[model samples]
Target: MAFRVREFELALMHRMQDLNAGKVEEALHGMSASRAELRAAHAHWTRLAHAPRAPKGAAALRMALGAPPYRGSRPAGSLTCDVLRWPLPSWPGLAFEALLGPGGEVWNQWFVRPEGPMTVAFTDLTPWACVVGDLGASFPGAVQIEGPAPHHWTVDFPHDGRTYRARFVYGLIQRLE
Candidate 1:
């Protein structure tokens, strides 16, 4: 999932660069607000690039929870993935998303569609919560509480067109560097 998202990021970067360079005009004319959200996502990925990679799944999970075993061989299971969109002002504020789960557990589903109304939703999710954080900040986002079982938690922002849909699913490594 992270791999795919990386590709998405690259595309977004290219698009943003084109827009900035005046190589590609935007359909929405002024999308500076949307661009800001993309910027946040870009910054978040830049930070993760410097973070130690967990060579094992266990290490990935541990790292997700922000635990010990500070440094050494990277664990395989402890991988963190961020698949978030830049929030539109007409919609909602920007959001930072992180998925932390066991290495083998895959969280696969799209939450929004490109050219459609923007919305956020989570389903068949466990750990009962998701943590949001700012760009490159060690401190995490508000610890959102979840209901029992795989519940569909969603947030609706303003929209002009039809409904948007995107899905994402990935695992978190359990160990640290």
Candidate 2:
């Protein structure tokens, strides 16, 4: 039970205020808005709840400036090498294909190694970027992004170098389902 994507856009703004207080279904696009356009889409879902995750040369120009994409399904569970920052060949990396979803693969894959002296801190609960793992390799796992809601990403390998950390604290549930 994981959920994010701004908690399903704030549960679709409380199901659009319980379907405008009358509550019913069947409105695939019958759409209705006002109350100042649902308070500006509820302030764009509270600015996507503190959206961040763009470092290292600006994640490809902040994902081409309109990033809100992720959509590869059928992955209910499996793949959790307990945060896979494996011995990845003692570090000499290059696995960058961040963001695709919307039915494509790679909803995030930034294994940008080369801090050559060990230091990696890719925290999600909101420390977006920190790389300096000075090259030893242990970079681990994290991949869950099927949004409209529910987002996650992890890639670490602290080299046991005595100074590598991780932290992610938005809704909680880093992995292990």
Candidate 3:
């Protein structure tokens, strides 16, 4: 069976369920999708991800999301990586990005701010309002820490002389502390 963008988005939500169940529920209602559908989508994605015969990395993403709208290269330490981005229907301003190593292996996959200026204030730091890049840009010198699970990230930024830690899943903000 072939997976489409909706399934991809559902899979994303599945990863986020642990951190933001209420938000996931709202998204599910917004998509008019049932919990069963979400579970099935995630299962399909997991199978595809692990199947030896299935397309891997960027190819698998292209299979599910179609061709990326943006393709470019970015410097990663001493090496440069190919970056591919595709827009998700639910998040107009954010795009799903995949960083491919020299061998075309996908090193990272997450939502990111597409090329453009992003202005974010503390007031705008609500759940699901922004991506990891938004906070890094808005609050310069923000420190990124790997989260407890895959696709999870925590960014610590300073504001009003206080530090805030924002949790994200798939690079989309889930909550703030």
Candidate 1 residue-wise lDDT at 40: 62
Pick the TM-score winner.
3
Clashes of each: 46, 24, 0
Q: What is the lDDT of residue 15 in candidate 1?
A: 34
- Which lDDT tens digits does candidate 1 get at residues 1-177? 242333333334433343233321241235433555555655554555456763333333333323421222223366654332222232233222223244433243122322332222333121211211111022223122331223122222122343322111111101111
Q: Candidate 2 on 2-80: residue-level lDDT in tens?
A: 2333323333444334313332122222344344444554454445444574233223323232342222223324532
Error of 1 at 137 (Å): 46
* Predictions in order: lDDT: 0.29, 0.31, 0.93
Question: Residue 15 in model 1: shift from native, Å?
Answer: 8.1
10 residues in a row with least lDDT, candidate 1? 168-177
TM-score to true structure, per model: 0.21, 0.21, 0.96
Q: Residue 96 of candidate 3: its Cα lDDT?
A: 94
Instruction: Give candidate 3's error at residue 164 in angstroms.
Output: 1.2
